[model samples]
Target chain A: MKNIVIGRYIPGNSFLYSLDPRTKILALLILMIGVFVIDHIMHMVYAIAIIFLVLLLGKISIKRIYLGLRPLLFLLIFTFTFQIIFNRHGELLFEETLYYSPVSIALAAAIGIFWFFTKRFIKFRLLYFLMTLLAIGTVLSLTLFPGTFATGRFAVYEEGLFMALFIMLRLIIIVTLSTMLTMTTKPTDLNLGLEQILAPLKILRINAEEIAMIISISLRYIPTLLDEANKIMLAQASRGVDFEEGKMKEKVVQIVSLLVPMFIISFKRSDDLANAMEARSFAPGRPRTRLHVLTWKRLDSCVLALSFLLLVTAILSRVLL
Target chain B: MAIKFERVSFQYTSMDNKGYLALADINLSINKTGEFITLIGETGSGKSTLAQHMNALLQPTEGRVHIFGITVDDKTKKQRKIKLNPIRKQVGLVFQFPEYQLFEETVEKDIMFGPKNFGVSTEEAAKRAEKMIEVVGLDASYLKRSPFNLSGGEKKRVSIAGILAMEPEILILDEPTSGLDPIGRNALLDVFYNIHTELDKTVIIITHDMNTVYEYAKRVMVMREGVLVYDGDPVALFSKSNIDRWNLDVPDILGLTRDLEAKFDYKFTEPPRSRKALFKALEGMLK
Candidate 1:
């Protein structure tokens, strides 16, 4: 089922996993912003180097990282084709009459960079330096390079293709980095980090702890919900309910029937969870002590400083440059 | 006054070209009152399918099912279908893992659902819920708590409470004690016994537990591969050598008593129901 991918975090321990979730989150955010800061090919080369260094430091296997890219192939191909067909200002590579322009080359280069950095982030073994290098390389390749294929009637332009590449790279980097943060960090750490990050809302009388509790519960239920859904699906199948063998509309109806039991079970589980929480004296406003306190280490401080610097650089490049 | 199936045959549709026959030419009748019937069968013995027919959950593919003089058939009139609801209301079915039927958030709500669905007033339903809560030997405080939060035994009790609130005349439980710990199973059996003795409701239990059948049931129905092989007194059914043929086991105490009777040339005036009963019978024979 598609839901199998939703919360499928493989349990492991490595340098990346040991880093505080807050540090990883902040670092990834910085790397994503920094990817857009580079405009030249040399800067992109540096970015690629940084990304690979990060991957090396993380100690993640290449095969594991490649698995994350499997689902994104179609999206990459689609973006590449769209850029090649539409961009119309670069030198024609294929035929002068067919508008086979330089933008196609740039688009493909951008996709390669996007795929590399994003795949590295999700795999969690890549070092920050390696990730940074990959990110910059991807951004520069899209921005400065000419299309590989162009024609006389419609030349594939470099600028528009770069823009498309930049947008896609940014999205992929952000999502993959976030997914990496989740994969490496324990759920408890993630919740605590969210609480700390959202602490500013306390000034407005918002309960950060309560919000954190909700977030933790939501994360905890993801795997549980998946398991319950699988069980219900199996149960329905045993009753001669063929979900896989059906037309599109019939499949939808079969899925609905499958979902009914899942929803019913979830509601019951939620009720149980609510009661269990209440029984444990867990009130919304009550202050609770943490077993694992969050403290900033030297590495965390470095990551924090780097994040702010990257953010500032990105904004400056956008406005001043 | 109760359900009677005459020469019923049922074939279950199978994926293979050669289909499976679930029930074959079975005839049985459930009495109106004071009947503790146990259906004993192996996994694919069509016992569950037969039980479903009692509540009109499944109509016999062949032959007639008459419940209180109303014949249950494929061509039964539409207006008569409405009558089946009342009959179904009377025949409360507790399926395997009956606890899964508990859908409401609160225990009270879960218990009241059946009564509410059957058009009972809120006040009456609440009253019934309280009575059932006591009947199931659960605390009143559990009523406000979630059914899912309770222990396994408590969840089973809540499920029973749900069905009991409907005030069914015939309560049918399918493997009510399966998967329960020994203590939990004993407590559940006590609940079933109380339902039979205190409420005077006709009880039909579907179980493979020969101990349960030997201890509580007045009548036993043995099914083997979709055939009703034995339908008679619990003692008579246990005494039959054909039990081995049906791949059924007699209760341990009953088997022991029978062995002693054959070997020592002695017989108890009445068959023992439990280990304690067997000891007492032995003491009586010695005296």
Candidate 2:
């Protein structure tokens, strides 16, 4: 349950924390665009380096950054695999064919056995399992599928492998960097910053304040809702709900038992919140006084200038090199 | 012993990675079935934390907890497959505001959910559900109604019925009458009383209501700031010289008894445990 780590803010005072919310929001946008603008491995390296530099300056724990990345690990693997499979540029890396001989069968069985046990025992089991899947896929293509690895026609392109790395690294850096933004920035400031940044959208009649309020309220209630949901789960567990020891169908039923109550609770909470908001006279679009007026300091400007420079460098590198 | 905690301490780790001790070196034993024990404390006094340990819901950070001889401690960690289902089945915990646990379409299904989860046959589960609904002073017809449709008090009763359907030997309720009116509170307390006396279950309750404590509790455990301050017969608990230091109000009847003693200088033996007891004793004295 703790794995739902998004929207969790850890209070800190660092360079990133001190930056104006608008500056932080803009920097995140530019950096995300820079990630996809990568054309060379060097560009990827530079992007990763900047991310690490920001993380270091923020004094955020690497373990927390890694924890933030945990939920995306599976999606990262999927994207990486799909990139390798679909991209067919550059020369072939390897080609092999194994006929149905006793030695080949024994080798396949041995690999399967190794994979099965390593998958169960290894610490980084998911990564090891992915490698095992790749190995088994290669072997199966060689023995079962004739036009692929079986006929020595199956090939993994070097460009495809490099591209996949670039994409995966790009994804991880973007997510980790954005998580840094959220982890350091208070939700109130985040909402205010977002409101400030989207002030221009008011020209088009969009209610930016209400949108910001929605985001802030949602962010604020995340931990509260999570805590409530956890309590409910425990209460149900005490009532003999063995969530871990159920069959798939029974597990679905158990999940319904949890999710339905959660839905009810969230709805009731929102209704109560709306009532409270109305009682407090929180009318939308009314001019409000700021407790902390966001003043753009010289450091905020310097950070913004540096990010823009990085963004330009990223684009120039994509174009020239 | 029904439940035993030996030097049990529980530490909760905050997001900042600092461990705060919630329960500290609590050594206690509940030995008998049909023994009504009430744990009374202010909020954050570790009353609920201690109650949770009784059902193995929260494990001790230091020392051990044994629920009906099922060891839950460092040794259970080594074994890795010590089934807690049996222990949990025997020790039913009805959480505060437990009505929130109800999610099934019908009250009967919600009530039977516990027994069914424990692998009881549907028929037997239904039977238990009907019986528990009656036990909680609800009609059997309530079995088919949506639990969501019930009033706050009725929802609480249904939720209690869900736990009672498990037919646990040791029943623990955390502030079971918290938000109820007087009548609702009495009705719920009656359900627990029946569970204790009639069904012969060892009932442990955590409450802040001193009146409820005096009325129902045979034995009372007092906790203050994670420490077990007092544990004994409720009558003995109230008579202690330092009872005022515990920061608990004396139950109303007992307060009246003391007031009567102060006014008349009567050395009354066998102080009343309930309003009825006090009234009967007062009539006897007048006659």
Candidate 3:
């Protein structure tokens, strides 16, 4: 539930905070391009440097970045494991013949059991999860058996490890960059910026304002829907859901017990919201007056120029370096 | 005691205000049976937070909460994951919009959800559902209807029945009768009161309705600014001079009692329960 902290804008009066959201969005886009354009892992130092500089300017804490990364930890680990196991590009760093003996299997089970039991007792849950992951990986790859048994070769290649870390780093950068954008920019301003940016789509007769409104409204409801969903979760939990502990089949049922209600609630809410909007004489795609209009200042242009320079540096590095 | 809060303080750190306390230093206890406790408060006064703590839906941020004698504290919860299924079973919490919790295709299956979740056999759960639908004053035929399609009141009753089907020893409801019309609210209150008396279950309701507090509650707890300002008999607590500071709406009966005391200069031993009772008390005072 805490992971869905998207659209949650942290208010600050820093330089990044004051810049036009359009500039920030453009900056985010260019920086993202830069991140992807940089093929070498070391070339990512430019993206990392700018991000850190943005972080310092924005007053966005490392803790917030850590929180942003937390929900993707499973994804990161899975990719790392997949790359380590499957990718066979570079020379093998290590090759081990592993056998799944009864004792080793029992040891794996014990590790799982130990993690399941001891996890609640541990305060640093992410570290504990990683520790458990490491333990399981070690048991899977390194365990040896004496008897003639079913065995497999576990090989760790240099390129695979490097690719895995690179991908993970790439993902972290993208997530952190987006997190920074959302964290710094208010949702309404972000929507206005989106509309402004999408204005060129008018050539195809696509209404940018409508699209922006849709995105804006959707962004607005994420927290509300999440709050409603959290309430429903607690309600279900009270009915003996044990959301964190149920079996696979029961968990599926439990999920339906959650999702259906959520679906119903969202529909009901949207209906009411639509009526409310209509009552307020809100017509989508209609030119609307704003209480606080977004303005692009000289500072915004400077920031955009900086982003352009970063992108050029990235592209130049790709060609020349 | 079914539930006890020993200096329980909860803070909602999810919000921007890091120092905002939802529940501050709450030390209270609910009996295992035969108590109708109404928790009254301003909006954001932590009544809902307090209610959630009763069933271990929320553990205290500070201090210990004993749910059916199982202590939930920083130390204990950190030591091991406490099995809360039994605790949840024994304490049914019907939330503000309990109807939203309903997800089953039919009312019967929806009501059976809680009991089945607690591992009651399907037959037994069905039986409990039947009994509880009746208990919540819903007809048996309504059980066949989709809970999603029912009127607001009916849906609420079905959701309540879902909890009641669990046969919790302690029932904690957060503003159970808030949105209903007078008759509907009265009927729902009557259903809860009957459950309180007949089944002899401890009933704790967090209600904004001071009338509900004055009418049904044996023990009334008033919270203001996350602090328990009052906890005592409904009549006695409402009569206190400092009750006004909480900015609470004076219950109609309490208002009448205060009026009678002011106008007639007669201090009644009990707060009149109804208009007729008020007249009777006035008649007695005149005599």
Q: Highest lDDT: which candidate? A: 3
What are the candidates' individual DockQ scores? 0.04, 0.64, 0.57
Q: What's the CA error at residue A153 for candidate 3, in Å?
A: 9.4
When superposed on Cα atoms, how far off is each prediction in RMSD?
15.3, 3.3, 4.5
Per-residue lDDT tens digits for candidate 3, residues A54-156, read 7887788989888878888889989988999999998889887767777777787899999999998899987998889778768866546445357788899
lDDT of 1 by residue, B1-287 (tens): 68899898777653233557788998988877788889998998998888877876666768878887778865553334435555667778776654346556788987886776577999999999998998777879989998767877678788778888888888888788877788878877888888888878789999989999999999999899899988989888877787787888879888788899999899789988988888899999899
Q: Can you tell me the CAPRI class of model 1?
A: incorrect
User: Which candidate, 1 or 2, has the higher lDDT?
Assistant: 2
**Residue-level lDDT tens digits of model 3 in B1-287:** 77888998987766654566888999998899989999988888888888888888788889999988899875654555678767899989998896569999899999889999998999999999888888777789998998888888788888888898888899989888877778888888988899899888889888888888888889999888889988889878876777767877788877868876998787886668766788888788888
| TM-score of predicted structure 2 | 0.90
**iRMS of each prediction in angstroms?**
9.1, 1.6, 1.6
Two-chain complex of model 1, DockQ on C-alpha atoms against the true structure: 0.04
Clashes of each: 50, 0, 0
Compute fnat per model: 0.00, 0.63, 0.72
| CA-RMSD of model 3 | 4.5
Write the residue-wise lDDT of candidate 1 on A63-140 in tens digits: 545466546756765776577667665554442233234564455466666766667546543354346544543444
When 1 and 2 are scored with DockQ, the better candidate is: 2
